[model samples]
Target: MYWTERILSEAETRNSGTESLSEGMRVIIGGATYTFSEGILRQERLCREEQEQTKEAFGFKWKKRDTYESPSVKRAHREWLLKRYFGGESSEIASLLHGRENFLDAGCGSGFSSLLLFGDHLASVRYLGVDISNAVDVAQQRFAEKGLPAEFLQADLTDLPFRGPVFDVIFSEGVLHHTNSTENAVSYLAGLLRRGGMFLFYVYNKKGPVREFVDDYVRDHIRSMSDQEAWDALMPLTRLGAALGRLQVEVNVPEALPFLGIPKGRIDIQRLFYWYVMKAYYRPDWTDEEMNHVNFDWYRPSNCWRQTPEDVTRWCAEVGLRIRKMDVEDAGITVVAEKV
Candidate 1:
């Protein structure tokens, strides 16, 4: 049942320094050990103190819990919605793979990208999807339902479990920044790649004047709010963003942001946070009250952070990674890098 056996096997064959890893197979972090099984890494431990491995300040645990009361289905819904939302970024991901076989989806939430890869690329690509939450169970099930060849593991990316120099491509999107140790996570994931392997990760990116001000204000204020309260507070801003998008008069700025759930925009700065408005501020699909209720649920507590292109580039450089490409999601940074 336990996959630790595989850990020792991989480590004995290929030694690793850390007790764990960021994403590359065979993570060796301080006192942790990760092992690969059926393409996924089985993460069995983290020796950090309870206070350190906590969600006290964030309001929820990084490891999603599954119970009858809150079945994994909810996370499943979020994953489905999030994947479709991120579907636009698929081409960006394709460029990272650049004709590779085996891959590791470090923080693959619900295996959305994995599905996209198999559906579009159909390269007989082997994918290992890992997440810190029990939500991974949902991902596993979804993969099975599709009858695709993939691996799924419920493990923390901070303490990855695959052998090093094992992955040709690593896809970690919008998950690393949520980790308590951002730099460590980046370095850890970096070490997992094979000599020519590539890493694709996405983290929040700082943005426009108005948006940046409000985000800072939220981090200062709503970081402590119950999910509902955070949603309520940000609703007005989302509405204003929506109004801006649907203006009768045309403002031909090179980029602005997407409206509330309004489609189309990768480079357009204006369309950047449309989903944020739909989730944090407002939702055109839902009636005002329903939208607000959903918005409330969306803004709940979790660990979150933003990064700049320069900061992320530095991270790769520190680890001796070669930058190949960079793709910025409205609120995140995703890049492809190869180990030097």
Candidate 2:
């Protein structure tokens, strides 16, 4: 079915009327004419102060549409997603997503990562992308440009429009931590999954003391800056990462420093800082804009929360989700779980 009809039929409440528009469709809600243009349905969401700030921050970040869409970066993201969420095989994605009735890209931003991970399989499912920011519009445009069919909604995580147990698969990548409460976000989204449905997500991991301190230190200064200001202010740190990466140095830790969460191993000098100090994302082949994008993503947002693996496991169990797969990395935790 077309997305317009699907939206009207699946919505929890009935609307007064809907009309076909040049771009997409329009529906009347409480005497207000809201347009679902280019597959994006705009909605008003009541948001907390921090959530509002985060929404604006990401909206600004993603508007730079093509910054991070390079082939290499896309390849890296696809590889990571496949490894962490789909048992390290691209073929596994078909089995996991095929024949699913409904798929939710919760917190989808510009549909970039979703396009990277699920572009090939989107045709097999009914896809809905939701974000708290204007990124929803960008997501719609991007999907349309690719000739892919999708429905998008601009809504907050705290107040989604969908009824419970409505989706068969949900994917939220690096988004839960940016909400008002990560734990609450987890439970609420899980409640939307039907029995035996899959919930795949990635969240920031709690880092060592010094790293956490540096992250907060940078965030405190950047939080008040305008998006452009913050982006420029973070260039030095990105440069630091590049410089360190160029050094091509490695450090050997003879003894594990349990107190600092440093394991005994041969670690790259750049990784030591990136993982344990502050986030200075580095990739030699990436452009300066691409590197700055990563830094801005980490520090510009006002609500980046970090959690331990235990916290994640408990959150899943508390929400009636059984862990099917989980991958732990220095950057964050990735989990693929199913509703019990």
Candidate 3:
């Protein structure tokens, strides 16, 4: 087994089926094991346990959230056409990162997103992908496999050992909310940029039905559930929902419930599947990754609380990060800022 995997296994033993141990966990990567000793859960052994307990918490050792991956992010402008995600206009954002030349790709998971975004943003951009796990190894391997010039480091975002503001641009996607101190994280990132540097981030919004319910489940109990526990927990919901949907009564009359022809009789299997799968892999409009991401988002132990647009604006202002643009997806929020 891989050293990191071994570390996780050992952590599991140490925790003895608990959510996490006070000592935390240690992972072995690149022939040396990097130790993370923050809070109790972040200890060498306990962090590993906490991470295992939380499914969506998978990322490099330092990161507390997953670097989302989906083919949808790479698809052409059909379904995502005119969508506000701005993934299509990545070239523009990449130019911002490229302007920095040597920048921090904060919370860079496997590096594909960075590669996809700022691969050509600059003439030569030294991208530093940071996380807390040997996930750095996976990211580095991806760089080598794809022959992309990039670097990965396993460390916390707060106590970064790097020198002064060497970055002109900072890219953090769908990360930060999972951090223990989200506000502190924002302030810290702002402190790492050059006088005129720019920072681009994607965070979740605090509104919407789908975002609300799912995030609640993750923060409360799912983050620490074992893989089996997550499966067990999600499986029953899907089964029960599917069953309820099956018991729907079919209607054949035109004016069944109203003057207009509206099909409202029993639970629709299509609707149920859509709802059920939004929480796992059996959705009407989703690939395997989307399905898994939803389920993981639900039961994973990481805290995924979203913030309002005003809240983010206030936080960025408080941290001295001036907003350039703001994009809010139902999943969360995205804001591009500059250190003025």
What TM-score against the true fold does each predicted structure earn? 0.61, 0.92, 0.65
Q: Assess each prediction's global lDDT (C-alpha) against the native.
A: 0.56, 0.84, 0.55
Candidate 2: misplaced stretches above 4 Å? 1-39
Could you say which candidate leads in lDDT?
Answer: 2
Per-residue accuracy of model 2 over 1-340 as CA lDDT, tens digit each: 3544655554544343543434544554433344555546666443777678889999999999667888877887788887888777778888888667699999999998789888768877888888889998888888889988788878776566555688899999999999989999999999999998999999999998889999999999988889999999999989999999999999999999888878899999999998888899988988878999989999998999999999999999999999999999878999999999
Residue 265 alpha-carbon offset, candidate 3, angstroms: 19
Give the count of colliding residue pairs in each prediction. 27, 0, 30
lDDT of 3 at 32: 39
Model 1 TM-score is 0.61
Name the lDDT value of residue 330 in candidate 3.
44
Candidate 1 Cα outliers beyond 4 Å, as residue runs: 1-5, 8-99, 117-123, 219-302, 328-330
